[model samples]
Target: MELSELPSFDFESIIKSAVKKKDTHPVMDLPVDYEEFNLTSEFDRDSITAFVKSGGWAVGGYLEKRGVMYSAPRYADGRNIHMGIDIWAKAGEPVYAVLDGVVAYSTFQNDEGNYGGTLILKHMVEGQEIYALYGHLSKESLELHINGEKKKKGEVVGWLGEESENGNWPTHLHYQLCIEDPGEPDMPGVVAKENLIPARERYPDPRILLGDIY
Candidate 1:
């Protein structure tokens, strides 16, 4: 859908409502010793995995402008602005729901640089609908639940996919949020420089829900 066609909302209000209804269930059982990884440049999978191992775990912040990592021929459109927070951990780490929601869509996208096995959940915060997209999940995750299934906050949803399953990236969870329903299991987790403004509007900073992990 065109960026112009996407619905707008009082993002602040939605965030406030979500905060008021905060569920402490972590999306992942991250370690207290976790550090943040700077993935703003191209790096091989081994490097990221090594970093994660060194830190016990690690996270990649949102909106980190990158280049070679997102360069073509995989990302042919020059989408280098990361719109999600990546939680780096060992492969097969279980992921949980951060909020109570209904499964909206699920699919396995096998293309390179894609989300691979993905799931999008629809949430209602004070009557305003929002979406959370879980990307780079294991192929087995697709069989864990069906579309329209209900998930409670903190419930086990899936696991981190292996490199062969998770679009050839290091083991991690690409967690993103949508102020408006993306209408699909997948949404653009990265965008070109020119689209940053609209992309920010559609995809708000997940930190509001994730809290100060940076």
Candidate 2:
């Protein structure tokens, strides 16, 4: 089946439940622009948690100014192009599988500003293979299963992690979809602006599976 034809998760329902329980901030509210406001200094774990608690979830960081953080010695222009949809929520919120797939990778990144507890699932649909990456997850999520394990659609796969374990950022889920194998437990969540076109071809918009949240 085409990517668009793949099964999708009821992200709306999940957000509704979270809002009702006060586990999340209001739905559809955009996060403060880190670029315009120069909120980089407050990008640490504590500050991010406070921001999410007060503002709700953030969407649309693709090619955003906050991409400056990811730009580094690795890229001459800096990889400020965000490749996923970040769902900011309370730590420990349960993360469910979006489709039936096998665990492709599960591990901790341990980098200061990286995906701490990460999980990558691989799925084959209509002879085409695809992958999903769930980053900054709670450490406990890694222990829930082993590599190659089969995960049914909508299964409880893991939970959001606190700053201590989730790469020292605010508790959130970095979800991405890949058309090609990332070739590792982790994939580049950001790329340089110059490479946006090609990179986008490899990693299509995750909303294809996440549904519309805008």
Best by TM-score: 1
- How much lDDT does each candidate structure score? 0.82, 0.68
Top model number, lDDT? 1
Instruction: Give residue 6's error in model 1 in angstroms.
Output: 19
List the candidates' TM-scores in order. Answer: 0.89, 0.73
User: Per-residue CA lDDT of candidate 2, range 4-106, in tens?
Assistant: 3334345423433432432221212233552122332334546657866664555554334353355334445566667777877778778888767899999
Residue 97, candidate 1: Cα error in Å is 0.5
Q: What is the lDDT of residue 78 in candidate 2?
A: 62
RMSD of each candidate?
4.2, 8.7
- For candidate 2, the TM-score is 0.73
lDDT over C-alpha atoms for residue 85 of model 2: 77
